[model samples]
Target: EAEAVLGRVEDVAGLFAETPERSADSPGSDWEDRLRDLAVRAVLGEPEQAAMLARASARELQATLGVDALRVMSGSISYVRRFWAHNLKGAPKASLEAWFEALTEYAVALSYSRRLCTRSVACAVQRERPGSEGRRLAADLAQRGDEESVDYGATCTDAYVAGDRVRSLVNMAGLPNWALHEGDEGAVEAPGPLHGCASICFNKGTVVLPLTDICRPRDFEERMCGRGKPCRGFAPGQLVRSLVSAACHPRALARGLEGRITAVDRTRGRVNVDFGGTNDNGTEGALRVTLLLSDVSPVEEFEAKLQSRREALGGFFVGESVRSLIFLPLQASRPLLFGAEGVVSMLDLQHRRVLVRFGGEEPLQVLLRFQDVCLMDEFEARLQERRGVLAGPLPG
Candidate 1:
């Protein structure tokens, strides 16, 4: 059994030497075909032939393609184990066991080979090869993991690994948010002039804002007590109470800001809101905010725009600060949705999706329709036209 295993190993090694030319003829072919061929030979009691095929495959991958076959093998251990499990039950016990042991050894060797390959690739890619796409590829792969985690690792912690170290350095040093200047007067102000409201341009290309009814303080209170509905002419008190109720309901708070319109921008179709004074630090300060709304469209499109901007702006590095802008669009009657401001971290443009990581941790993703962009120049133009009509020089 020992001699048989040794012979099989040697045969596999030899097969690897000749694989390059064979593989070149069928570019991007998977290894399963070669595995199956080896299996057939082995089942026919031609262990040497099976080994030879394996050897050639490994050799071709390494020599011709500059790939480390062993490293590739290591990453594939789980797959090999699965294959073994699938075929184990019906095989001759002793022979099957010996083959399994040999496969395990192969897996270990492959893993070590992969590690070396990964190191080699890292070095080669770093010499700043002309037209080297390594940096882009690395960035793409890094994004597959959690952005916050990657950000933290690359910035807060100094942990280094083969694949993550360079990316960590790039991300940490390249994307600092210099837009936010420390000791700036605006940074220390109590509730800076409410910047802007949120608005949405819908997929079908409509922009809408909640109806604004300014009333006396008493009228606002009556409306809230249900003595009056949300029609015009509620006393200011009724309006205020109703707004407070909408802004402060526990469920609304959970959905992010239930019932209040803190400020309004008719031209932008946006609202500056206070979500019942619950602050991020869990203190009782007003949650001064702006949020964008889309008319029943998925919030993803806006998210994509935000993520794309973040990447382009190099906004992901540590200490990089971003500002918030909210947009909201209203239909005749429906629940208002949330919008965003700050650093966008992920986007799926094909799907028109986006996710923003706010306050360094919380991530919000929204899907949006094409028409629901508040800042889109097309929509803004329409808004300006409407405003001009409403303000028409007081009919002199």
Candidate 2:
């Protein structure tokens, strides 16, 4: 298991190191040191190193890892300065079971550390690669230096920065919110004057969901909520609460909730959405999803009415939990529903889709249609509570 983990780590790290920008720098001078520090922490759960495992490489460390009586005794030693600081006469005795337990903890920590290292390197290299087509287009507009403001269309993030060169974005969870700085005035807060509302900025895309869309609900489809009851229309930045049955895709419990609209084509009756920004799956580009405008009536503005938890929340939190299987049809005769339980790793609103990663030793990422996935039943109550908070109405 340790060997397999080491191999995977090396493979990912090698790829990251070989990138054009990274290759110019060669092996980081402190990379090995950092790895050693991580290994020591994993093994000892502290900075202090055992006598036998001092300064060990991943391979060497793996070989030395074990909590057998002999191994523990060999690794644990106290100093005796009787004759030029000779080693202790005998190793501290411990039960095999205890040793084994300690060893297991170390191994788990080591594996975790390896994963962290691989992910860190991969993220650094990813940013150097080319961005999505829409991102490139936006970057181009920003480069032209003539337009006072560039419009990336509705339901999209990755806001244009005036002079910043186009840079690649990597998928990693828990990164500090991306902030735009303006001279000495300090960090520019979200939705700053650009659009009037709260927004979140990502290294790859900036979420600019319009505040108006959030405030005023649009009646989208009558059949979605239930028969004869019109469901709300999703705006450019809003999420698809349910699937469009006409799209020929089965409803997935969690996948449908992943997408965020990036662009909407009224003439063509199509919307572009992107998924995944929450986990190791990285930020995949937006996909063009066809909206059944002919069959389904267009979203119409509705009068605001005070209600309890029935109101909709415009979007979902990235990295939300989801079931493994999804409903995707592979053939006309039979629909293929395949999926492995995973988390909503990323959410691209512009080109609607969600990225999911199955839990395992090896990292695996898959993309599913945004509309097909739905929030799990267990989460419905929580979703309603969040909606109540965002929509600002008391529940009955």
Candidate 3:
């Protein structure tokens, strides 16, 4: 047992007193049992317990960050296998979306493996140097060298795939001591590292969630309808209204900048506004700034006028006509199978879900986020080419 557990004869002394009068058999089998228990606690029990704690920590991290997923893994005394999840909160929209997709792909791969263990499967969202806002929360466990949180960011195990039996969802994978040998009773250390486990630590605010919660919904549409949020770029001569407060925009347009969008890159989330060569204060040569779907609201005058005209024309309901295309809105962190596009068979805003048909199928009740519901004719064909670039490739 000592050869299997302690690894070497010389190390056996480390488990008991060094006093010369002590006999190895003096304490009998009872004493040996106690020592064996100590070895098990130090070798296996402690690490499993740490993994349980790491799971809790991962949960806390998710709630605080609000990202789609944030997983952490820590090793046992010598074996490392653990994982947890969290959300990335208040992150840049592009990063948030990218990470969310990557995390989903990671989850899918795990499910495909058909194996379940608390291992980590990585789907990188791109490692970035935290922006000024993100740096404040950044921490590298290696730099701290603290004892209480010894396993906080240790990486002793290889990342792999595991899942819940009922859900068939894969979420985490971690490395274990390569030299571990399973015995009839439990695992026994063979010849390998004396101590150390896998460690991963992050410094970010996130909320904790179960790793399985991050998996993508089964069979989402591979092709997205040109519908959904207005991600199409504005023409150079097109006019747009600013949706942000004056403080957030360039100083020259304090009264609110309503100008032609000279340049726009929907992928980069940037826009250049030409206030027509010069302004009254001449304070604006041009305003090139970051813009998001939320930073640009519809022109109220145009929206209100359009609504009135539609209402006067009998009704203002979208998908009211036969063969109208409708879409379901993406949820926060949770992916849905049929949220992309469907043909409108019936329209009733009064009802919670709309009745829509998909590809010659019977009408199905589907919920649509008001924002996600858009007229199909309104979708730009050119924008479809850019969809893959913006949303990233489909999850595996």
Candidate 1 yields a Cα-based lDDT of 0.33
Question: Which sections of candidate 3 miss by over 4 Å?
Answer: 1-237, 248-252, 261-284, 291-396
The TM-score between candidate 1 and the true structure equals 0.25
TM-score of each: 0.25, 0.17, 0.20
**Candidate that would win on TM-score:** 1
Best by lDDT: 2
Scanning candidate 1 in windows of ten residues, the lowest lDDT window is 165-174
Candidate 3 residue lDDT tens string, 2-81: 33132333444444335343332333323223223323222322333223333333333344432222222222211211
TM-score of 3: 0.20
lDDT of each residue in 268-307, candidate 2, tens digit only: 3544333434445643322223343222222221112111
As for lDDT, the candidate ahead, 1 or 3, is 1
Residue 396's C-alpha lDDT in candidate 1?
12
Q: Which segments of candidate 1 are over 4 A away from where they belong? A: 1-7, 12-77, 124-253, 257-396
Locate the minimum summed-lDDT window of 10 residues in model 2.
179-188
Q: Backbone clash tally for model 1?
A: 71
Q: How many residue pairs collide in each prediction?
A: 71, 32, 42
